[model samples]
Target: MGYYTQAARDVWTLLIELQPQTGDSGGGISRDEYISQVARDIQSKLPEVFDLDVIRKKLGLEISPTSVVLLQELERFNKLTLRMIRSLAELQRALAGEVGMSSELDEVARALFNGQIPVIWRKLAPDTLKSLGNWMIHFKRRHEQYSSWVDEGEPCVMWLSGLHIPESYLTALVQATCRKNGWPLDHSTLYTQVTHYRSEDEVKERPGQGCFVSGLYLEGADWDIEKGCLVRSKPRVLVSQLPILKIIPIEARRLKLQNTLRTPVYTTSMRRNAMGVGLVFEADLFTTKHISHWVLQGVMYGGRAIDSFDRRILTVYMDEYLGDFIFDTFQPFHFFHSDSGGGISRDEYISQVARDIQSKLPEVFDLDVIHKKWGLEISPTSVYCYESWNALTNSPSG
Candidate 1:
């Protein structure tokens, strides 16, 4: 009823039904971990019990049985049922990897547990089979868009990778973005094109000074309030003409660390029911100065904010409780893994990042020549050296 599949909803009902949740159960385990418990007990063990009292006390069930089972038949199921339970748990674990992907999990469950397909698929709809097949369709297309941008040398980076808008709304937006960014995808991880984009329509200089995501994110341009199309305009700038982000810092604008995370953030391209068909048009409703402490780091490690917008996406907590559940179940997490390359030494990479920064924000004696690129009015100073932007902004004239 809430933003989940019927089966997923049942899993919630069943957990409370099977055992009153202790704080440990609620706080410690994730949805995937909790699902393992459901597969083991409620899925494999619940059906084995025929005793009315056992069902009532253990499973919290009150269903009346239609027929009585003989002792021999009951004995057959009662024996080695633990093995079956263990096996089901293993299956759920195997499925966990596939299901960890927010968009793909539903299709994985639907395929692996589709009753006839894997024989393991049971009538355990109560355990939340979660055949939200449509969600996967949506993300794959979004993934295509992601692959295109990241390959085209302009990765569609985001800071809060945890944000998963309600499935319906995300799908709608993904649909729109895919059409807009119809560039081809290149999956090779060997090399990435780090071009500079001045705006959505302007991408000049291949292997440009820095990587920039074209088009600033319109502060509140994209949304879904009671069913409407998404709106994307230029992201709000800190200054009138400058593209400096009010939300994200200048250092973060550097392309190198654009998608870097402080936590083991989940990153995946997912969508919901994308036939690659038509667009959903929504009504347009129109709608912070803060220097980030990490600006110097961003200048050194981050790319130029030549054209990119903030990677923050706002979500409406439809219900605080359900909203948390939606994020947990839909966002796929990945471990951080990077190996040192033989060609590009760490120092070399850092140097390249610095060079890229220099290229984008070259020095000019006259602020009147500013149309060339954005730079501090003071001196030809590398942003990496300036610890505080306040010091730079408060040049002698100010």
Candidate 2:
């Protein structure tokens, strides 16, 4: 049968089997009452479906002859499902304001989803029920995690604004680098002691700045050919050092905006330069320069670098000017301006920039891929794609 037809049959079967009794309760079941009763029945039957033996043996656990859970419990006992569920549960509990952590429960969930628990637990062991109870508890926690991540939206701050490394590989890289450099590494210790440097001024003021630093200022370290190994630096260092992380490959794309449009001539910086005269003419006559500025800025921040002259112009525009003139002059075609002429608010702007970078940049930053290749889990969050923007924003050190 086709997927939709099969799905329809299954859903209809479930509704029929779990439908509310019609003999009592004001003669016939109201729609709302029927739905409520069906939900309650489903909840009651969940334990039977989650039975250990049934899951281990991969038996189809159906509520009725025609309907079964869409996904098999044992089949989803892998890393991706586990991580997704864990993230979901954690967020849910956090939003609920419940102190809902349980290490024992977590262990049982890991055993079940990771396929660590024995097959015999399905039938012979009393601990099987206990394991199921633990599974429920952990399942709740995972739900909380997922909910929290979703409500907050995209991660608090991506490592280098969506540099595409999974959290696991990033963590492992950090750990390995620390170990190599003889720097101490522990999640709790690092959490409390971390600091972020946004500019050279901060780095100068605090030269001993350790790992947890983030944002646009500090660059990563790289191998110095003359020094024979990786040596750390700033500004330029960030891009250079990325290759050493071995998370993702960085590639550069080049484009010329001037060729795309045609316009009249005006004045030129060099009186004899035709190209210069053409550009100046376009800028003066049609306000092309203003629109060009916004488009170029969008492209640059979106992770593509312009030519030398274009890059210089963009740097001046982004750094020298402090207001929304770039956005304003561009008007209706404000490519980078996300929030209309009222002006893109800070949060909105940041989110837009981050999303653009993430989408445009290559996925070389995934820590999980790095770890699987190198046998390490560098970042605590590396096993999954989700990151906590709240954690990053609330971090005192950053």
Candidate 3:
């Protein structure tokens, strides 16, 4: 069998075993039992000799343990899993109706219940953690990102979306620049300069100043490669992938703004409602258009799928869309397969849904009615329903 095939099978089996159930009878288990199963799985994955320092000393390689990527990655994974095990244990205890539950534990439980990923220290986006299939996909993406970094070794262009704490990396970049140039760390601040490279592979070397980062999605605007500046999004494109970005540390005193828009960067499309979430940073994007153009469009950068448009339309006009729906009355099986005897791809499905919603909207409400009744002012000419739907459902990494 192929390597990834075997890995997928292993994870699929674990997910089946991790299914949440209630009572002590049949092939069922409670939520705490599910947590216990995950804890045990994590324990099994951990190595007995995960401490690299001790391993290095014991192996008589203390002078230089090589600092291999595999070794470092293993150690990092071990630490992460160890913390997860501990947190899962605490959560399991709290699930048993135990008294005196800490606020953190309460938050964790609520996050899990609401289908959101939960970090012991902070809240993650509603990434469908309660849905094991979705969680598996999320886990695979994170693992792939980490493996890519490990294989590449201190990437020239980092994938910002793959990080759990992107601010930490951003801060570290400033710190490294400050330390290298002997500048006071406190006096340094970050300034982003967007590059023209479409992909990370195009970046051959690191900049002398800070770092190059990728995997940030731009909403409500697009970067014109030839012009090297922000422009209005394409006719049918709602979110556009930003090219490699040069994030440099500058002396706070020297920092100046000219013809740039201070764009907010959010961790996820859910915006502020997600736990422990807000604008992670404000990037100064080069723009020829007036800043108000983007501000009026609610333009921003996001870590993952940019779903603000989706939420506004989907949640508010849900009744209207559902009422006029001509498609098959939602069946789980129909989702994966098309009635035309061909399997529907994920993008195809998203497009189909978006088009269906788009077709129905004008029949029921025009731009004026929509804006007046719902207080949501969408562009009258905007026909990027596909992009909006993709942002809400299946935005592939950029």
Counting clashing residue pairs in each candidate, in order, gives 17, 47, 1
TM per model?
Answer: 0.18, 0.15, 0.49
Per-candidate RMSD, Å:
26.5, 31.0, 20.4
**Which wins on TM-score, candidate 2 or candidate 3?**
3
Error of 1 at 16 (Å): 13
Give each model's whole-structure lDDT: 0.31, 0.34, 0.61
lDDT (10s digit) by residue, model 2, range 47-85 = 211333543244344232101211222223233344434
Please provide, for model 3 over 1-398, each residue's C-alpha lDDT reduced to its tens digit, 9 standing for 90 to 100: 12234367558757754654345424376555555565455445433335666544544553222234335545555565566557766877776766457887765554454344556523223222235335545545656665555456566777776566567677777766776789998888889988878898899988887789887888768888888888887887866898888888899999988778888887764455545465567787987765544544557433432454443443334333333232223222221323223466667878898999988874322444544664555554543653454465555662
368 Cα displacement, candidate 1 (Å): 81
Worst 10 residues of 1 by lDDT: 263-272
What residue runs in model 1 are displaced by over 4 Å at the alpha carbon? 1-131, 142-207, 214-398
* Candidate with the larger lDDT of 1 and 3: 3
- Worst 10-residue lDDT window, candidate 2: 243-252
Give me the displacement of residue 3 in model 3, in angstroms.
42
Clashing pairs in 3: 21-29
